[model samples]
Target: MSQSDELAAQDAGDSGDGPIEELAELQVKEEARLEKLFAEQREERGLDDETTLHTFFKLFDMWIQLYRLNKCMEVLPEVVPICRSRGGDFHVKGVQALAFTLWKKSQFNDAVKLFHEIEDLIGCSAALCENMGHTYSSMGNFDKASEYFKRALQCLDKEEELGKKTGDRAGILLGLGLIEDRLGRFEQALASVRESQALFRQRANGKPSSLVAKAGMSIAKILLKLALQEPDDDKRQEMEDEAIIREEENVALFEVTCGEDSPLTASALRGLGEAQKRRGRVPEAIASFARSYQIEAQKDAFDLLGIMEVHNHLFGAHMDLVKLGNPLNRASFRNYLPTVDLALDRVRSMKQDANAGAYYKVAGEFAAFAEEYQRASKLLSEAVCLFKTEDDSKVEGLISHCEELKDFCDAQLSAVRGSATANVSESKS
Candidate 1:
């Protein structure tokens, strides 16, 4: 037999083992060798001599890959003390990684401590400050987040004057935009996002980068916010139309650069759903949100998926059982009520969190459903209270609606008691 035929016959005899498996085994061996090299370098540098810092870092990275964020956090403290003791360029990098890992694991206090430590060691890099701001923002301390984001911008500006590349500056601008958006500074957010978009477009030589995807997503978010604020019917329609166009473009860019499975793609899909909802395309909006929710769920992005569902309902994709049409339509609507109720229940649970306002707004959405209105009103009133404390003008309408509902409920209770008294008097007569 020829050599190829002989190997094929032997493979067939061995139950069809193939070259792909051999390649995978070779890759694993190569990775092991590379990891060994990293460990040797760490030991020679005397950083965690007994246990390699590189190995710990690699293990933490692997934990993140496996979606074991809590485990990653548990390993981080072990590496951090060694990095702090042995001060070097890699030490700063280690601090940054640890801070980010803590932030991802929702250990905000630890993240802040590490960020402060990094700032002291590195003398304030924009990247460190921006990440600290992100950690604060995730913790719902928007004011503190905005302060750090501004500091990051200042650092980036100084670096730019010293002839640094534009990449860091662009990143700072994007960070500022996100912080501003969260704080409801829509105009400032737009300006920051646009600046970042311009910078990314200038940097793109031909192919798309992750930066481009980020910029597109930021601009889309700004546009969506603007659309929401527009009060004039024609103006709002125009804004929604523009937002839809931007969303489609962003989705295309995200798919091309990061593929459909990435968080950016999921965000773009959610934005598209929002725009479609604004345009009164309920079915299309629901479909887009459903896909976005599926992708986010697969990535364990539960909070983000919940936010998307809230918007889906807020945009008037009927979640209640009430129908304005025939019996079949009523049945179809009824079929969706269970899902709607589940979403509302999840939102209600989230409202018990420190940041209750976000969930309350979502719960308030089901207020039109008579069966759910009382709960919705209570949630809406709580949201209004939070927003009122923040000096948000948008809460006025919600507060008024909540008061009206409360009054209506009181009146109904009084009428029921009066009727009971009348029945008792008639029975005595």
Candidate 2:
């Protein structure tokens, strides 16, 4: 057989073996040769406690190949001290890798510490600064995130002056736009995203890329926000129409770039559904959300935030579908109630999380749809308490609104009971 065919045959034989099993088998087969190589390398380098990290590095490599992120994290704490003791490219690569691994684990503090190490080592490059910015953004520190992102752009600009490739520079713009959006600097966010979109378009080799699609979604989302804030009816209509157009374009780009069943396409579908919901296309919105939810449900691994958001959207779509006064949809609406219940249970368990306010608000809304008015009131009340405890001034207005909603539900329950009591009294008479 040719080399390719031989490799293919070997792959075919191992295809049925699980990832851990395959790795174990390979390690067992390579033990003797690996031992000899390791001994020679240690002898050459004069092995020490710090040098032991070089051996631990192999575990991280395996974990990366297996998508075993938690395992990578477990190995990282052991690797870091040794790397700090033995300074070289090993230290540099180890610090960067540890920062990224910490970021993956959502341990933003440790990630930022390693980011500082990277900065102290060789100063910040575009990638290093962008990573710091990303970690800050994930921790909900928009101001710090924006600062680093801008610094990243500056670094990339310097690289361009030196005739370097300046690859992925547009990503800095994307990050800046996201942070700006979080800070409610809509106009600036729009400009950055538009610029990033143009750059991605310029770089695309015919096919639409994920970056382009994401930039389009950001534009659409910003437009939607602007439309909601617009005072003039005619101007608001124009903005809404533009948002709808961009949302459609986003779906098209995602379908082309990620195919229909991929997570990217599902997210695009969800965005389109949100736009359709705003346009009062209840049936279309319901269909889009159902499709997105189905696609996401088939995947075993999904971020907590994404899964919660999908469940929220699905609940809202079902509620909207029922609002159309369609009997068929009324029954189907109940089918989605269980999903929201499960999602709410998960969110309740994460009550101490930073996102607790949003999660509680979504779950409360879902409960309202299920006619569990008391449950809705309780969840909204907890959400208010969490927002207060978390010192989130940004969402004070939202907390007030949900509090009012909880009170309204309480009033509704009282009214229903009062009417039922009157009917029973009349029947007794």
Candidate 3:
């Protein structure tokens, strides 16, 4: 063979008759391996690449998990891009998840922005509108929340024709119930939740869904709020009884569906704890609250609130014991005061309208009696302002007490001045 031909043959042999085919094959293999790793990670975290209910739920779960883990930035980029690429059901779900994550992180403005984006994209869905309402409500924007809740109910009404096909009537009803509760429409809330419960019963042959437990909890919470709003002892007792029944139902449902360790189970247990506290069953309430708090720490806001409430109840129980001249209870009262104060601080920070006024009132009274006069005055002012805005008849006694305290302080000041002047006159004589 000629030298040039031999050289060409050698080149061909070196290249395998092409330009680095093996290198290209190796690059493809590497890409596949990386892709596999990505898929595995996604699956491990309960996320999917497609746009289906399962995928949406997986994404929701992942979003919640990431949010709880404080890994928002890590998951936000990956999910947002996928949502933008696949604009449909997945987009709506992504937006909802993003909004919830933002809300959880206390990014209210960003959460509102994502909520609006979802509303624009999907026109109106009951779930989206309800969630937006909840976000607004949490931010203390009740007017806007009410507006969104109305829109959600409208959406549900419009889609009523497709109820059989969608199989989400109960969900829509529950969403409406939540909105009603937020808006302080307790009767309406109860009606909606009861309707949802009935629908679930019909569909599941009297078996409650996990969703029903949530609805029951909502109803129970609303009932408790209503009881708080009532002045008449009999009426309050009736409402409390109703709340207890609803809470019991929620606990039973959670026990049946979620086992002991599930978050819902913890929540239901907490609801029972709250009911017990209101009924003055201190020991039972403490046990339930402790169990719920143990299931989840400060991760769940509700759980945190429950723990705080339990501490407050314990403080009250100890105070009662002290009043009965129990030395042990007096020691416990002193030891728990700081813990109670911490819990109250957390509850104040949450700024839930339902509890804010009460917390402020309690803090004001505690401060005044504890000789923290300046703090007492500020907290009392806050309580008065919130109670005025609340428009509940039940706060009349509290308002009256605050006014009496203000007047008494002024009188005491004048008396002190008079006494000081008399002492000066005596010294001069």
Question: Candidate 1 — which pairs collide?
Answer: none
Cα RMSD, each candidate:
13.6, 11.0, 18.2
Compared with the true structure, the alpha-carbon lDDT of candidate 3 equals 0.59
Among all candidates shown, the one with the greatest lDDT = 2
Order of models, best lDDT first: 2, 3, 1
Those runs of model 1 whose alpha carbons end farther than 4 Å from true positions after fitting are 1-78, 105-107, 140-143, 165-167, 255-259, 301-316, 319-429
lDDT of 1 by residue, 23-131 (tens): 2233345446645665576657654653566555554443332234455555566666777677785577567666655555456788788778877876776666676
The local distance difference test score of model 1 is 0.58
Task: List model 3 lDDT by residue over 31-139, tens digit each.
Answer: 3554455557667764445523333344334334222324444566677767777788667656666666666655667888988897788676665666666566667
- Candidate 3 structure, TM-score to reference: 0.56
Better of 1 and 3 by TM-score: 1
Best by the TM-score measure:
2
Total clashing residue pairs per candidate? 0, 0, 0
